[model samples]
Target chain A: MRPLDWVVLSGTLAFIVLYGLYKGRGSNTISKYLLAGKTMPWYAMALSIMATQASAITFISTTGQGYVDGMRFVQFYFGLPIAMIVISSTSVRLFHRANVYTAYEYLEKRFDAKTRTLASIVFLMQRGLSVGVSLYAPAIVLSVILGWPDRLTTLGMGVLITIYTVTGGIKAVTWTDVQQMLIIFAGLFVAFFMIIHLLPPGISFTDAVYLAGAIGKLKAVDAKFDLANRYNLWSGLIGGTFLALSYFGCDQSQVQRYLTGKSIAQSKLSLLFTAMAKIPMQFFILFVGAMVFVFFIFVRPPLLFQPIAMRDLESSQVQPRYAPISAQFDRAFDERREAALGLVDARRAHDGGRRAQWLGQYRQAQARINQARAEGAGVVQQIHGEKEFNDTNYIFLSFVTRYLPAGVVGLVIAVIFAAAMSSSSGEVNSLATVTVIDIYRRHIRQDAPDRHYLWASRVSTAFWAAYAVFFAQYAKNLGSLVEAVNVVGSLFYGTLLGVFVLAFAFRRVTGTAAFIGMLAGESAILATALFTRITFLWFNVIGCAVVIVTGLLISWLRPVRQPVAA
Target chain B: MINSTFMPTHRAEMPDEPPPILGSWSRIYVLVLVYLALLIALSYGFTRYFS
Candidate 1:
């Protein structure tokens, strides 16, 4: 990075932090600290909700997913709008009318305290583990940018976010999320246009699109009904809906965002806004990745996007084996580039025969490229002893730091840091809220004064922040940070969603029945994860179904107690 | 009927006023669902056209 880049990066971060600290002033009481005094407008909460979900990994890895796996992944969000509508019509009013500090608190009012505690603990565990991955996402940025160790970067980011979050509370998290969301949008637009402009001269936007389509990068939907397939339309609609319902309706990190809205209408509006905008936003990000893939067709990317991995492979004993693979990769890239250009020309000239020929050649060249990449990955595995070696998370960052101009590179990096901080702050803040409100205050010191609880909240925030940093120190070995975080959430979200579904839909299900059903649901999900080839998305569905069925069965089998004569 | 006392009485609160744009909350929900269906259809078309 140049001097100007550092100036822009530091300047943007400093302005955001200062603005957050300023806006977050006067959060003295627990309610003000945790919920922004329920005074946030719909737009602010909407942006905050978006920013929370769109973590640094969303930018860094999702674009890479688009490049490597095509846009079929967009189907994963097909269920999200439906989930939002359901939550808006149900949970939004439920939580707001209850005037609860956390989603789990609603569980106590709806079910028994045991169910509430069980749900709270589930959230804390899932969110706590995922928060580390969130912190690890931006740590990858600083590690790549400055060549600092990932551990040190994670530590630094954790401390910086913890300070602001513990001091200003959700007010800081929400307001700063708004600023960060704006910056993130700006960075994305700039990077998208830059990718288009950086394309080879005479390649119009339509040509670029056609080239991406030719290479299969533009396949955004798959209509197949296979359950094992992760991103098909059926999985996206059914399994994805369950996952989204668990995430938005039951997860505290998201629940807290809308809960801060001044009124029920405002909360519903915020969610509806997300439903309307999220798919298009994802399309834009994935489209950026597809463009990057096209750009690399002309400009050869490294055999592996991760520079450190490549450097290690070069110096390892497997270097001899890797050399020929690198050569073949270069040859394949050149051939693919030629085919792509020829295909574009043939299409422009309306020659179907020539177009078919070039398309055949293009697919063949792509096969060769894939073969070379597989060989390279094999060599890297030999050197690193890590079987699931993937360089996808490095693709976007490698592009930004190498290709973008100085100021813009810094802006994109700032966008990444903003995403990381926004997401981590919300997770850490929510973790603290659940710990204090659900566990500490409810179970430990029910009669404590407001000031005492507020102090405990800040302290718990720091505790969870430190824990995330500690866990992130080891999170670097995880293959894809985005998938890793989601997988962790999926492992637990099903049972949590199941319990919530029971509370909402089945009044006859007793608390004991619901609690046991939740345990059954969790066990079933675990078994599925361990012994089946089903995709992780389906875990949510399996879990919710098991919980509801078990709860109802147990409720039916139990003997009804006779009421004493009045 | 199952015991009513065991069931918690925390019913969802109804809004005093109608939604800002839509005439009612149900309409707003329907509008959102309709938008979602349109989005899915468009995405399907985009995929088929491209692939």
Candidate 2:
């Protein structure tokens, strides 16, 4: 990283931390610490929600996904608006009227304590496992790009976020999220326009779009319906709806964001705004990736985007295997670059026949390029002894550091750090909130003073931060960090969603039925994940369905009993 | 369960008011869903045009 980049990165992070600390000053009570005292405006909460969900992994890995896999990943968000509409109507009012700190806390108000406990444990487990990867995913890429140690990067980010989040609490987390999100928006705009500007001479923006489309990188929607197909419209609408319901409706990280809102209307507005905004934001990011793919069509990219993997590939032990793949990759790059130029020239010449001829050659060369890259990844995987691996996470970063100028490079890196802190801060804060509100106060010490729980929340915040950093140190290749994080959530989120569904939708389902329903839902998800070829997105659908059906069946069989008032 | 001090005493009565726009919350929700359908349509257009 250059001196200008360092200045931008450090200066931006310092300002955000200080600003968060300033905004978070008055969080002395349990409510204030966890929910921001219900003082947050809809705009602030909306941005915080976006920032928290748009983790560093989302920012970095998603662009790389666009470059490698086309824009199909965007279909995954088609269900978000539907989910938001569902949430705005149901969960928003229910959660607001209940005046709960965490979403799981509402479970106790509706069902028995065991059901609430089960939901809380599931959230803690899912968020805990995924939170560390949120930090680690970007750190690994930044380490490769900037030559910094991944461990030090994770530790430094963890410490910087902890200072504000632990001190200022959710207030600190939310306001800084607002700031970070604005800056992230600015960074994305800069990166998008700058990448387009860096495209080859004589290639106008329209021509660049044509090139990306010609290679199928611009295929954003697949309308076909297949259960195993992960990103088609059907799964996105159906399975994506379930996953979004689970994440926003049930998870504490998201629930805590809205729980801080000024009122039900404000919180509802926040979610609806997010639903509207998230898709365009994601499509733009993927478009930026598609543009990066176009950028590399003219400018040569390394055979392996990750530097460490590249070095290991060329080491003495692996060089013999790596040489053939390297030669193949180099040849493919030359052919692909030539065919791209030919296609562009044909477009400028307005010759449809020549365009088609060039397009065919362009696709053939592209296939060869993809094949060479796959072989290169195999060599690296064999060298590292990892089960499955790719450098898809490194594509965007490698493009930025190599091509973008100094100040913007720093800004992009700052955007990354800001995203990491924003996302991890929310996670750590919610993890602590659940630890204190759902588990500690409810089960362990029901009569504790607000002052006592306040201290426990602080202590718990520090503990989760420590745990995230420690886990990040060990987090390695999980393919694309964005998909890995979501997959991990799906494992547990389905059952969490099921419990909430029982609370809100099925009025007569008993607490025992709900509790047992959770077990069935989770077991079904686990079995589906282990024994079937179904994609991760369907896990939410399967689990929620199983939970609801089981709960209904059990409720019918059991004798009627007076339920405890929540 | 009898400890009142365990809860926050500063706030009470979470009131749900009508949305500032569209005259009501349900209207606002319909607008959002309509917006979503349009977005998917546009996305499909982008896909079809590009491919």
Candidate 3:
């Protein structure tokens, strides 16, 4: 990156951290430290929620997903609004009324300590690993832009976020999240407009959309009912809803965000805002990716978008084998560009015959391009010995650093850092809260003063931050960072959501039954994940179903014991 | 027996105020669901139109 890019990136990051620290002042008490004294407004909580969910991987891999796969991925969020409404109505009110610091705290009030502990451990296990992946995602951006090693960048980001989060607690995290989200929005709008601006002058927006649609990249939804298919309407609605329910309702990171709202109404409003905005926001991001695809169609993109992988391929023994494919890919791109332009002219002139002819040529050229890419992927796999060698996560970043002008490039990079920090801080902070409130204070030192618990919170935050940095060193091996993060969540979220569902709806399920059902549900989820090819989205539904069913059956088998009044 | 010491002060009071804009929490939730439906329909239209 140029000096201006460095200036913008550094300046934006510094301002966010300082602003977070400034807003986070006076977090001395445990409640203020952990819950921001329940004073957060709807807007702050809403942005924090959005920022936490939209990690750097969302920007990096999603746009690349748009380019390579199409916009069907937006359907993955179809259940978010529904999940938001459900959670706002049920979990938000329950947690707020109960005056709990963490979601698991309420599980104990309804069920038993064992159930709450089990759920909390599951959260730590899933979110703990995912936070590392979140930290590792933006390191790819820094690695590509400044040629910094991934390890150093990950460590740097982890430390910076840890410092602020440890000092200011959730207050710093939430307030900075609001700022980071604004930067992300600015970056997204700038990048989208820039892509349009960079497109050849003759290619109007509608013409570009036509080309993208002709090549099957503008498909924002698929109404097909296929369980095996990952991103269709059915999976998105059912699986996505279950996932979002688990994420927004049960996950401490999100629950904690809304829990900081000034009142129950504020919390509900914050979540409802997210419910209304999330779908359109995701659609816009994916559309930006689609536009990036259109942009690359006019300007030749690299055969493999990952620069490091491309360099490694050039030096590997497979270079000779890849050479012909690279040449073919170039030839196909040239032909496709010509056909795309010709199709636009034909459509303008109202010549149906010529339009059809160029459309066929464009499609054939696209097929040839795909074949070349497939060959290149094979070469990459052969060289790396990794079968799932996908460079989708690197595609948009490659475009940004190589194509965009200097200051904007920095702003985009800042957007990435902002995302990484916002997400990682929330995760680490929530992890710390769960550890201290659920485990440390509850199990270890119940009678400790608020000052003691506050100290433990900071220490726990630091420990989790260090652990995330250590785990992030290994996140490089995980393919498609976005999918990797979600798959990891799916593996655990289903069981967590099931436990919450049982707690909320199944009043007769005893604590023992719920606890055992959680174990059974987790086992079933694991079995499905190992033995089946079911899409990850269904894991949430399957896990929740198994837990509820298993809990109910176990409860029915046992004689109902009258509740011993506490 | 399950421990009670870990539990916070349980004051499961009703929310003090109604929803600010929609006048009721249930109405706000319905509006969100309706918004989701409209979004999906529009997305489907976008898909079909583009295709």
| Interface RMSD (Å), every candidate | 3.7, 6.4, 4.3
- Candidate 1 lDDT, tens digit per residue, A10-72? 898888888888888999999999999999999999999999999888778789998898788
After superposition, candidate 2 runs with Cα above 4 Å error:
A316-324, A477-485, A561-566, B1-12
Tell me the lDDT of model 2 at A274.
Answer: 97
lDDT of 3 by residue, A1-566 (tens): 89999999999988998998899899999999999999999999999999999989877878888888888998999988889888877788778877899999988988888898999999999998799988887786678656989999898888789878999999999999999999999999999998898998899999988878877888888887998899999888888899899999999999999999999888888888888888888888888888888898889998888787778767757678878988999999999999999998987898989988999999999999989988888877877787677777787788888889999999999998899989999999999999999999879899988999999999999999999999889877766655666777889999999988888776677788889999999999989999999988899899999999999998889847654886
Q: Is candidate 1 or candidate 2 better by TM-score?
A: 1
| Candidate that scores best on DockQ | 1
Q: Give the per-residue Cα lDDT of candidate 3 at A446.
A: 98
Candidate 2: tens digits of C-alpha lDDT, residues B1-51 = 111211223234767789998898888878988998898899899989978
Provide TM-scores for the models.
0.95, 0.95, 0.96
Question: TM-score of predicted model 3?
Answer: 0.96
What is the Cα-based TM-score of model 1?
0.95
Greater-DockQ candidate between 1 and 3: 1
Identify the runs in model 3 with alpha carbons over 4 angstroms from their true place.
A315-319, A477-485, A563-566, B1-11, B14-16
Counting clashing residue pairs in each candidate, in order, gives 0, 1, 0
Every model's DockQ:
0.45, 0.32, 0.41
